[model samples]
Target chain A: MSDSVPAASQSNRGDDFDRRDAAWYVDRLVHLLVFLGGVSAILFILGIFVFITREGLGYLTASFSPSEFFGSIEWRPTSDTKPTYGILALLTGTAAVSGLAMVVAIPFSLGAAIFIGELSEGKTREILKVLVEMLAAIPSVVWGFIGLSIMNPFIIDAFDVPVGLNVLNAGLILGLMAAPIMTTIAEDALKAVPDHYREAAEAMGATRWQVIFRVVLPTAKNGLVAAVLLGVGRAFGETMAVLMASGHSVNMPTSPFDSVRALTATIAAELGETAHGSEHYRVLFTIGIFLFLITFCINLIADLIVRGIRKK
Target chain B: MTMKIAIETHDLSFWYGDFQALFDVNLSIKHGRITSLIGPSGCGKSTLLRSINRINERIGNARSTGQILIHGHDILAPEVELLQVRKEVGMVFQRPNPLPLSIRDNVLFGYRLHHGKRGLKSSERDRIVEKALSKVLLWDSVKDRLDHTATQLSLEEQQKLCIARLLPVQPEVLLMDEPCSALDPSATEAVEELVWDLRDQFTIVLVTHNMAQARRASDECIFMLLGKVIEHSETGEMFVNPSCQETADYIEGRYG
Candidate 1:
């Protein structure tokens, strides 16, 4: 009986071993999951990059005349006579369009973000924020459609342009589409600033505009820069909006009125017609590789900028 | 040490929406003197300092009864531009808030706004910035890399930079809300010494919950409780002789 009592007590103690408090257990699980999941996702993403690079980078290394892909300037693969797939044209177009979009989007988005985050009143600020959020929820295809219908007429008539499907239209639409995401992220970053900063600036006899432009914006610059880089990435990867807005002729567009085809749109447009494993298909994949590299570089830059700001 | 009255709050009362934050608090801020507002937290010490410069207006539906006179001009008057009011009355906060710009930019931000590009030549601007830093005693440490980002400064230096930024504008009154609350002992000492130095050029309303800080820094004391001015006197008189039992009990540490 004494032996039984001791043995039962030991078994009961063992039963209580992993039975932690509910709140404590939940807290521990959440931390564990978050840490594990975050690392695993990063690893999985990195593995995808390695996979794509290994498969797709081979064509890039092929003779152009051994290295025609990166070194060539031409992009017409539909025509015969061993069509050249040099990505210089598509790349130039991407750079131009993305740059223009950023120029339009960054300022307006930053302004909207600041205005929405800093200035507007209780209900008005909330409403504006919600409205901007709704804009983000609108599908990319709907934005493309909207650009074709209303935007086409508005720009064609207002600017006296023959066709609205020019770089200007594409950039304008892209800016509009990108604004919501940009403004939301930027606003979140700006809102993250402590109230004490604004109070300090105001106390320093800084005007409202001064407080905003000088103190708030500068202080939150890392997040603000991240927001802008994110917007540029969106503009680069966007297919339908650019496809509908940018006139898709293979020839290089010199003016805003002239139709431009971004690399993304070109891939989407010609992929079906091109025979699989053909040089054109390989070129499209090669453009994909280019895109992957560019986005990767931008993400790296954004991270570096954030880290730099943090160190300061 | 003899100086004019830099600011006077006459029966100033502030309300956040329907909730009153301060009531009928009359006080005078002497130039080149630090007047500390001491009370328990949430006792309207910070609120009263903020209302002095009409900062409460930034809040939605904030209103005030009574007037704030910065050199006799009623800030509450409609004709007075708030921007100008802020310029005349500068503030320092508990936490050091330096802009995320180069040390030079953070110091001259106020100057640049008021002066614009035409106001000061780059060389002149540098001199002014240097002078302002020297006033706060941060020049020697930060002088080598004036163009480096402001965040690189230590906490004490950052708060000093905030002070330097205000020096450029040369505001008549300076309002400080717990300026040394977030600092270590040495940093707090640095701020305290600078406050004593700056009082010659500016009227200061220094707010703190620490009674010792009030005694150390202030010439006059305003004691607040439940959003009302419970007592106001010269620091010596208020500390040595008590008028109200409540004040006596509070000073005796009955309850915060």
Candidate 2:
């Protein structure tokens, strides 16, 4: 009814224009193209997951019976009439090695992270951070060579261990590789805790250690868990290092000094020799499926735990 | 009222890198009396309070050249133990901050730090923790759940817990910098009452921008402008007969 009415409507009109700006024919075409392009990429990648399962899962089932599969421990699958496909030994080996690696890695990494996050001087902190970050960027193959050439012998001598390429040797080497990544990520998480908590602690006459233990670590629990999960993911997928230094045996681990067979090593060793469509090849694929499931479930559980923490 | 110099600072100056935060703040504070420092933003009221507890020394890139004596101990001297100075002088910040600990642990943490688990068992620690909470008037509501995390308490209760957390060590001085800045009116009143109750045992120095609160709570008010202490006088006299034009200007809202 008045000029003010037009001014009031102008703000709404501006909002409408904003809502419609990206809806013109050209913009719509561009958006549609992007959506289609992303979907196409996903479908193409997903096809690999499907094709592998289709080609691989059938071989394991057709090659061996449930009884044979459950009971067999020998993994030296050679071309013969009576084939063995026992993976209990292999599965146990991988689980033991991975679990041991995590145990060795978590405490040292978390402590170093807290030191870097809380106590280090500015220049020293940056240098230490750079060193850890560089470790994370180093190739897995390089780590393997270093472990074989240097770390394995030290383990053999220091602990008076038997085999140079046993689970303990491999696990220790892998733990070293994972520690830098764990430290860097956990440090970042600890840093995410607000300055207020630190000040509050100090104001209450809390020593620096008390502040770190009671406040910084608890507040950054989500981030610390994320770091550990990420470290586990790296340890799971590692192949060259585990293959090279793990002594590559199908034997179940008795202690840190026993040789072991991780899933990745089994696949790597067998993939080149097996003929396509053979039972061995299918069984190999099934092992791949199982490995993928383990890693997937670990990550999914970690994500759920993180989400639960955030909701609180 | 008996007047005694509880704490004193001489030619006190502080800097954060090249920027001066406090400039030659020479003031004397009385024991067991509330002294309110009122000023506009960037006027260095907060800086003065932090220096009293020697907390400013820990801020990275911050330096001070001053002689602050807490109960006649040279706080700014190189030989003075920072921890001992801190143990005698406590602080409460603008925002309510409770450590991520059990409510009971928060109160007894000081004893655990300074004494290292000697001369007190868990039972005695709990009693002192309870007594500290009662001093701040929070024991009744929170007594049922001493084991609950301090973070779960309401904002005001957390602030009171912060105050209570400082009591067990029996600090001679309490420095509060804008303690009610993050609180509602009701919460602010509760804290004001606690401050008044605390004056019997602790020397209280508070910084506030709220003139009404400054008038209501403080016995002696020190007015400042542009990092200079304008007038340090009794609250009633300073408001009625301000000696400086800058103090009058700030009080009347003419120019900040």
Scoring each candidate complex against the real one, what DockQ results?
0.57, 0.59
Model 2 stretches with alpha carbons more than 4 Å out: A1-49, A59-71, A79-81, A152-163, B117-120
| TM-score between candidate 1 and the true structure | 0.85
Per-prediction RMSD in angstroms? 4.7, 3.9
Q: Put down candidate 1 lDDT per residue, B1-256, tens digits, no spaces.
A: 5668777788888889889888888877788778988777789998988888788777878988888888888999889877688788887877888876799988887777777757578789888989999988989998999999887789999989988898888788888889998899999998999898887778889999888888888888888899988888889888899798877777778989
Candidate 2 lDDT tens digits, B1-256: 6677889988888998889988888888999899999988889888888878767756789888878977777788999776677788888989888877899988877767777767888788878988999999999999999999998998889999989988888898999989998999999999999999899788899999898899989899999877779899999988888999889888888865
Q: Candidate 1 on A77-111: residue-level lDDT in tens?
A: 87666677777667666767777888899889999
In Å, residue A217's CA in model 2 sits off its true spot by: 2.0
Q: lDDT (0-100) at residue B6 of candidate 1?
A: 71
Docking class of 2: medium
Clashes of each: 7, 1
DockQ of 1: 0.57
lDDT of 1 at B94: 76
